[model samples]
Target: MEDFLQNLLNGIAAGSIYALIALGYTMVYGVLKLINFAHGDIFMIGSFVGFYAGRYMARHATGEAASLGSAALVLLLAMLVCGIVGYLNERIAYRPLRNAPRIASLITAIGVSFLLEYGGQMVFGPDPKFFPTLVEKKIIHLGTITTTNYQFIVLAVAIVFMGLLQYIIYGTKFGRALRAVSFNFETASLMGIPTDRIISMTFVLGSMLAAVAGILYGLSYPKIDPLMGIMPGLKAFVAAVLGGIGNVPGAVVGGLLIGIIESFVGGSQFSSYRDGIAFVILIVILLFRPSGLFGRYEPEKV
Candidate 1:
């Protein structure tokens, strides 16, 4: 029971990371009906950004300086850098193809993904870099479940960000504009909403979330490679679909579930095939609950 509980906690933490990145995939897809495949690369960039920034900060700090407060600051800086990178991606690569065919947009997104991957290598180099330690590796006890300070912090940040996004989507004017645009771009524009701006904002918000996820992942594992985002990004997309694409709450649910499943299955003797768990879930869900757990079924009107 204790072992199972510990695995559960770990799974939830891993899933939270997936959910954060998955939110980006679902948001862009829901609003624009575009997948934004470059999202993984955006996450990769966030890892690099956080890696360099954390290293620089550590280099200047006094010996053995590790605390929750300092960790929070590092995460904040990483979030900002990732958010800005996501905003720029939309402003430059995706915005121009807003009116293009889905195929075209997808191709453009793939191109952008390559650009970031190779460009990241060109600038940051191809070697994997170690992330500076921000948290003291102390495991916390929670009655049959022991978790690290790092896990607790990561989970807390993921929850806070998710809640903040929920508030923005449900309680803010910008969120209202986003919904209006999502429903119908032409009608939204007809009603005085700046459809273009809202679209851009959606991308920016999603990208930032992915970046944060990437940073958390780096902190969790302490090793980051340029291509790390590919698997996680793909899994996140599966999570978005599982939770019901376009549904914010669904994304969270799906992400956490996928993470947990992968962890348990991987922890078993089948660890070698852990990466395949997400796709298995994706296919199973599509074959059965096509609309997703939290996703609404919309029939096309004639």
Candidate 2:
């Protein structure tokens, strides 16, 4: 039972990160109907940004007194940088292909993914760097289960951001415009909405969420590399699909489910196959419900 509880806690922590990244996927898909494959690379860049920022803070701080504040600042900087990168990615690579065939945009996204990966290797080197410890490590005991402050921090930050997102989507004028554009671009444009600007804003918001996940991931694992986003990105993609690709709340549910499954599998003898579990779930979900768990089925008219 203790082991089960431990695994559950671990699952929630990892799931929170997956949820954050999955939100990025869902948001972009909701708005543009295009999968931004380069999003993972944006996440990688955010981690590197946090890496440098954290290191700089560590160097200048007198002691642990300023660690938490420094970590918050690093998160903000990383998000800002990634948001800009996402904006450029949309403008330079995706915008031109808006009217092109879907295949063209898909291929472009893949090309951009590769470009970022190789470019990152050249700039940051292929070697992995250890993430600076932003907060002192301390274990919290809850009955039979033990967890870390880092886990709590990850969960807290994720909840806060998700709440903010919910408010933005449901309560803001910009969000209404975003939804309008997503529903029908031509109609929205005719209604005086700036379709182009809304699309760019979507990318920026998604990228910022990815950036949050990246920083939280670094804090949890403390080791990062240029290609670090690949597996997590894929898994997060699966989570997005599992929950209903364009559904915001679905992404969160799917991420938690995937993380819990992975954690349970890892705790068992089938640990070696943990990585494959996500794909297996993806396959099962696709087979049973192509529209996804949370997605409503829409019939195509001939």
Maximum-TM-score candidate? 2
Over 4 Å off in model 2, which ranges?
Answer: 299-302
**Model 1, range 1-302, lDDT digits (tens) per residue?**
88788878889999999999999989998888888888988888877878887777776665554445566666677778777877888888878877787788899889988888888888988898888786667878898677898788789989999999999998999999898888888999999998888887898889888878988899898888888888998999999999998888899999999999998987789998899989999999989997899988886465
Give TM-scores for every candidate, taking all chains together and pairing residue i with residue i: 0.94, 0.97
lDDT values, one for every candidate? 0.86, 0.92
lDDT of model 1 at position 67:
49
Candidate 1 stretches with Cα past 4 Å from truth are 63-69, 299-302
Name the top lDDT candidate: 2
Q: Least lDDT summed over 10 consecutive residues: which range in candidate 2?
A: 293-302
| Residue lDDT tens for model 2, 229-292 | 9988999999999999988999999888889899999999999999999999999988998778
Q: What RMSD does model 1 have?
A: 1.8
